[model samples]
Target chain A: MQVLYFAWVRERIGVPREEVETSAATVADLVEELSAREERYAVAFADRAALRVAVDQTLTDFDASLDGAREVAFFPPMTGG
Target chain B: MRIVVQDAPFDLGEEAGRFAQADAGVGAVVTFTGIVRNTAAGDLKAMEIEHYPGMTEAALTEIAERAQTRWSLSDVLVIHRHGHLTPGEMIMMVATAAPHRADAFAAAEYLMDYLKSRAPFWKREITADGAAWVDAKDEDEAALDRW
Candidate 1:
């Protein structure tokens, strides 16, 4: 599956997108897995309350199922318009 | 409905002029334009907007569809720009046309409210000292409760 980060999350993660080989069933599980990989991921995922998630390009909660999903994105609350 | 997510700057007058005035039944046309502004310190140089390419369009379309379903709107137009934008430049605009003033006004406000928080766009301010991301406001999120 592919995971993406945006805004300051992208800055902190040091990459916008990456293809991850994981068997996580939910967004939270995926975050936990990623956070375990390195220090930057740990820091970026430290405060889950400050982040938003999207599963397959649709806005969703961290508990959302990643069943058959191709993409997941994490970012701060949008500040558009 | 016209939805435009572009990197090029748009002229409000030209876009407003091209809006659908052809339908005589459309009695009220309400428009709102968002402009970039310097910080209170007045040292900001530009606002860099970043957006999720595919998701931005999809999210905007969903918001527009919701507006149309909730109101008796004849037309809706949304235009947003991404990339480096200087202070005072227009960032985005929404125009709503309806048979009555009430629906037009309500739908326009709804669109603005949703676009501000729902769309997958982020804004960063570039100042003389440094650059920083603009934080989302609680009021912007609360505005959706009115609908």
Candidate 2:
């Protein structure tokens, strides 16, 4: 699967985007997997309450299913104008 | 529906005229323009905005659709600028038109709220001391919950 980060989320994770091979089937599972990789990932996913997730291209809840999902994005609540 | 996401400053009058000309069924037009603020109180000198090429547009289009469904809007226009922007510059514009003010106003606000909390754009500010990434505001998320 492909994982993407934007805005300050990208800064916290140290990368803009990446591809991940994971056994995770849900958005929460993917977060746990990435959070285990390093302190940066941990910090990025530190507070799920401050984060927003999108499955494929639609805004979704963290518990949303990701079965066969091609792309998953993690970012803080958007503040665009 | 007309959505223009660009990096240049736009004339509100011209844009409004264009959308008005697109259809005559529109009786009320509600437009919202976001501008760069000179004083942010936080660490900010100048700001730079970045967005995901295809994804940003797709998400914005979907948001416009949602607004359309919720209102009797005859036409919609959304224009968002990218790259570095200074104070007083236009960052974005969202306009909605309907037969009544209620529908036009609701649609415009809905699109703005969704764009504030859901769009995939990032803004970074450079202050007198240093540069820092802008964090999403809790207020933005809360605004969406009202709808």
Runs of candidate 1 with Cα error greater than 4 angstroms are none
lDDT of candidate 1 over B1-147, digit per residue (tens): 999999999989988877856567888899999999879999989999999999999999999999999999999999999999998999999999999999999999999999999999999999988999999999999999988
On TM-score, the leading prediction is 1
Candidate 1: residue pairs that collide? none
Q: What lDDT does candidate 2 reach at residue A28?
A: 93
- Which lDDT tens digits does candidate 2 get at residues B46-134? 77888776778998999999988877888888999888888778899999889999999988989999998788787777788777667
Candidate 2, clashing residue pairs? none
Q: All candidates' TM-scores? A: 0.98, 0.90
Chain B alone: TM-score in each candidate? 0.97, 0.93
Each model's total of backbone clashes:
0, 0
Regions of candidate 2 where Cα sits further than 4 Å from its true position: B40-44
Model 2: residue A31 alpha-carbon error in angstroms: 1.5
Tens digits of lDDT, candidate 1, A1-81: 989999999999999999999999999999999999999999999999899999989999999999999999999999999
Docking class of 1: high
